[model samples]
Target: MSFTLKPRNGLPYAIATRLPRFPFALILLPMLLAGCEAELNLAAVSQETSHASLRTDHYQALASNEAVSVLVGNDGVVLVSPDQGLTWQRQQLPGKPGLIDVDACPDGSFIALGFDNRLWHSADQGQSWNVHALPTEEQMLTATCAPGGAWWAAGGLTTLLGSQDQGASWDTTSLDEDAMLTTLQFLDADQAVVTGEFGLVFNSTDAGQSWQASGNLPDEFYPHTSHFVSLDEGWVGGLNGFIYHTVDGGQSWQRQDTPSTAPIFNFSANRDGLFAIGDHSSVLHLSGERWQTVPTPNAPVYLRAASSGDDHRLTVAGGRGLLLNLDTRPALAAQAQ
Candidate 1:
């Protein structure tokens, strides 16, 4: 099924782009009141049946930089490491606001954007945080920092904000005022791209000083979200497992067939290929034009934050502080050789 963004009272809602062809099933459960902990009945469902491969005991979550890697999630904050998901810590915000995304700045700082248009900054590498009032209460869905030390975030109502002096100050730009932004990538100081609700795609060449819409990516492709892996290569994933690739910046995009229908949350790539992670603790790899499902020893864990370093190491963080390291040296070396 495909979905599009519809604005309701200035907030974005996911609406079906087309009706389902098969019989649709709707399950409604009692809504939990605020401040209630949700409990799932795992006894009724076997481990094999659950798409998530839970390895909660084998991972260690770091509370700070040395031992812990920080990630933003539906919960407040999460720290992850490879030492068996061993240690976990939570930062109590002023309110119980669930964080949607976290970006660690180059200066060992962190910024978290979340529901209600909230923004928090931590200079001590997630040790302590201070909340900054945003221009609006619209959810800031995605954020990224450029190598040049600028930060940009996008979310509800098609709003985009950029900061030149880190998170201390921000300048709101009039980019995509009509579309909801779901993902953001800053390729460099003067170039970046954002994708979100509707078939919306925007690009900026002047460091987000202005933006132009690259409307309605091909109809065969879904527009649930989009992301860039490098300055020249990018991929967008959508509902019904649709994936699209771009080679010449965002001038053109081509559809890619993937194996799973799971909603991809984030994507990262190196010279070797592309990697996408999402629901059911699934990971998808794309080499050249071929896509494959890789078997991981860790099970039922969400792969959330992913960052590729110059050393060909792809670091991923997810469910219960699960950290994954996929070595790209062999594949990359073979490609180069």
Candidate 2:
């Protein structure tokens, strides 16, 4: 379970409690007490916030806002939390399709992609769904909705589709086959980029109307996720622990180093920095230009996706119900066994 509060203008923080949850603690000492006494009690209060760890089936994707958080995964399994993930309920969807990725819109709607290369939409926060077909049959890996009422989907073997009518239908763009397309991101109403297997990265300028092949590095780099903080600066992470950075709007790229060689399945970005999560206990962090490692929990699941909201809280979702929240405040831990 998770808790959501309206965010103040503070640094973005994500905290993922480990295998056994610590009591989530945000110390607020009562002012009515003697000042000296309250100061001493503050430390003790932080020790009492522990509760049961949230348990559920393996999760594949997560999305959220100030009010709702949704986790989707295999067998049409969906969990929705109204209170910023502090509480959850099983949300019944229409099909048993293996859900691959999900995107939450600003207007309380949700869109999901799956194994069959189809798009599913829910107006009621994942309680039900309906399918929207793409232009191709390649397995749809990732999708996003733009602010200007357009939707885009990218997937295997050079498959790219664009929808102008909010995904009622899609048109096949001319950027045809080379490798498996894995991820897509729209920087704004007019610009977008797509990445895939064989180190393929494509850029679009006219609202995905056309494309330009920009980055083609080593053959093994399959960029599964991409995040752009600005129109010029961005990063892509994928298989073989691959991470590439670009500054001139994909004009050129450079590699970043991390200790773990595990595949980086996904990334989430906010005002604070960039964070990537993946297999083999790998969490690569970028605060400025230099990259570092953020240790992850000892769960046996590849963290597949992350959603960073406007608030500082970041929710990372993966297999075996691996949900980790990394934040600034200290969570109350069990007193060392």
Number of the top-ranking candidate, with TM-score as the measure:
2
- Residues 221-301 of candidate 1 have per-residue lDDT tens digits of 435446675645678875545688888765687878666665555676656567776544555677667455544433444
Candidate 2 lDDT by residue in tens digits, 156-265: 55777878777767787646765567678777778887776666777878888888887564544656677876657778875556688888866677888655566676
Output the worst ten-in-a-row residue range by lDDT, candidate 1.
21-30
Task: Report the Cα lDDT for residue 118, model 2.
Answer: 72
Model 1: lDDT of residue 163: 82
Q: Count the backbone clashes (under 3 Å) in each candidate.
A: 13, 15
Tally clashing residue pairs in candidate 1: 13
* Residue 230, candidate 1: C-alpha displacement in angstroms: 5.5
CA displacement after TM-score superposition, residue 330 of candidate 1 (Å): 9.2
